[model samples]
Target: MQMNDQRDINAPRAEVWAALLSADVLKECVPGAQEVTGSPEEGFEATVVQKVGPVKATFKGQVSLTDMVEGESLTLSGEGKGGAAGFAKGEAKVRLEDIPDGTRLIYDVEAKVGGKLAQLGSRLIDGFAKKMADQFFENFQSVVEGPADEGSEVAEAEGTDEASKKKGWFGRLKG
Candidate 1:
């Protein structure tokens, strides 16, 4: 499957680029991501849990950044195995452009699934994929913008930790 999207963040392009490369930010933004280790330069290893339709599984994967052009753009590629549930592999090309409001993050992704996951209908998988992507971006945007008030700051900090513990993975195919 293929997906493309763009979002405007209320932050400078440099700040958005830094956040994208930060393991801490990725851990918080990626849906269902339980743990993320390593850095952009060294690559990252993560464990994620996800449920699509009737299939639910845990995936361990490695993602590496390639074709980087400083703060402008980069490509991330990775693959994961979910035992009997299935396997997924994909790459995403992310581009950051300066916008009047802040930064516009545009991403194009291509992904494939195998094993049991391949047996599901395309419509089901597509819907699930879209939903996962939406959730990921929404969480990411919230993290980038941060809390608007001091009182909410404390709550946001505590909530991020709790949310990470409860969530599972970015998506079946996202690396």
Candidate 2:
């Protein structure tokens, strides 16, 4: 599958760029991310979980970033598995554009799946991926933007504190 997503963040490009580079912030931002570990030279090792249709999987993926152009763009690829549920390998090209009041972030992603996930039918897979992507962006936006204007509770369901960090779903997948 292939998808494109564009978002305008109400922050300077540099600030947003910094957040992107920070492992802690990225871990706080991505959806369904139970844990993420990395070193730039070593790439990102992440474990994620999700339930699609009736199938469920805890995917462990290693992501490598290449063709990096500082804060402007990069291409990242990785493979993730859901155990008996299936697995997927995909690549995403992410670009950032400076605007007058904020920055525009865009992702062009392509992915392929095998195992039970591929067997589930395109409609369901596409739907699930889209929803996950949307939630990720929403979480990222909030992390950068701070809490909503309504003064809502913090959305750290992904777990942020040292305690939660040690006990998070991602922590369980660390290797």
Candidate 3:
């Protein structure tokens, strides 16, 4: 699957770049992510749990940034395994541009799945991927922007309740 989109963050380009590289921010923003370790200089290892259609998976992965142009753009690539569930590997090219309002983050991602996850069909996987990406960006925006403003554009951009929806029906059932 592939995804390309952009989001405006209410922060300077440098600050947004710093936050994107922070392990703490990554752990908090990445959907279903449980932990993140290591640094941008080397690589980061992460563990995440996600539910897709009827499957629930815990994935352990390693991610590294390449083709970097500090504060401008970089390529992130990673691979993860979910035991009997499946495996996923992908690469994303992320770029930051200065906008009058703030920094605009543009990203293009290509990903593939295998094993049981592949059996779930492309439509389901694509939907799940899109949802996860939206959640990640929304979370990142909130974190970078700091505390909420009742009537701010950030608050009104997307409803909090919708963003917090259950990952999948199977996840609710399992819980």
Best by TM-score: 3
Model 3: which ten-residue window has the lowest total lDDT?
165-174
Q: What's the lDDT of the predicted structure labeled candidate 1? A: 0.79
lDDT of 3: 0.84
lDDT per model, in order?
Answer: 0.79, 0.75, 0.84
Would you list the rank order by lDDT, best first? 3, 1, 2
Per-residue alpha-carbon lDDT of candidate 2 for residues 48-91, written as tens digits (9 for 90 to 100): 87788998789998988888888898887888987898898888
- State TM-scores per candidate: 0.82, 0.80, 0.84
The per-candidate count of clashes, in order, stands at: 4, 2, 0
lDDT of 3 at 52: 89
lDDT of 1 by residue, 4-74 (tens): 99998877787778777878788887788999999999999989899978999998999899999989999
On the 0 to 100 scale, the lDDT of residue 172 in model 2 is: 34
lDDT-better candidate, 1 vs 3: 3
* Candidate 1 residue runs with Cα over 4 Å from true position: 150-175
Clashing pairs in model 2, backbone N/Cα/C closer than 3 A: 34-170, 35-170
User: Total clashes, candidate 2?
Assistant: 2
RMSD of 1: 8.2
